[model samples]
Target: MADPIKDTRRMIAEMQPRLHPGKYVFCSGIRDDLAADVANVAKGSFVEDEGMSFIIPQEETDRLGIAGGVAMRQITLMVRSALDGVGLTAAVSSALATHGIPANIVAAARHDHVFVPADRAEEALAILLARQAEAQVGS
Candidate 1:
């Protein structure tokens, strides 16, 4: 794998955000015993105070009878960003917030993922792309 980018500006300029190709939903209240089962089917899962929160495909949500809310779509930042990198999330979230889009961010070892309302996925993408373009021009 390529070295993770450390420069905040370059990270934003080359992040190459890509939208995952499906609708996802947030489901909670999954019992610990069932966490493994849900994880096996979910695209992403996180532990929360309420229970395990699973970001699962809409189809699986229906199939598993999981209570889902706020259908969302994932935008994967294709930059290999360092775990301790600063400013990337702030910049992305600020851009999205300016457009009144709520962004739920997940930072993994290799990349950052943003989940936005399913209906506003394209708009969110446009904002991110524009941010990147502007960063490139500035640099």
Candidate 2:
């Protein structure tokens, strides 16, 4: 993988956003009995006051009998952005918000994933593409 991008403009300019297939929903599980199941199934998770908030496949919610809200789709930013990179999330969210789309971002080892309402996934991808195009010119 290439060096993680640090410059905001360059990061945006090179970010090739691609939609990840399938729908995902957040589920909460904190019981000791649930740890293995969650660790095996959750695509990602974050600790929350109520429980362990897990982003798992929508199907798992049904299987696990857990309540989930707002089906979301992931848009993976191909740029390998530094974990401490500045402004990338703000730029992404700002661009999406301008079009009335909400973005929930997760930064992993190699890329940043943006989760948008499933219904707006395609539109969000387009907006990111346009933002990247504009940034390319600026870079």
C-alpha lDDT values of all predictions: 0.90, 0.90
Give the poorly placed runs of model 1, Cα more than 4 Å off.
31-34
lDDT score, candidate 2, position 16: 98
> What pairs collide in candidate 1?
none
Please provide, for model 2 over 1-139, each residue's C-alpha lDDT reduced to its tens digit, 9 standing for 90 to 100: 5778899999999999999999999767546776787669999988887867889888887776667789999999999999888998999999999999989999899999999999999999999999999999997
lDDT of 1 by residue, 102-122 (tens): 999989889999999999999
For model 2, the stretches where C-alpha displacement exceeds 4 angstroms are: 29-35
Worst 10 residues of 2 by lDDT: 26-35
lDDT of 2 at 1: 52
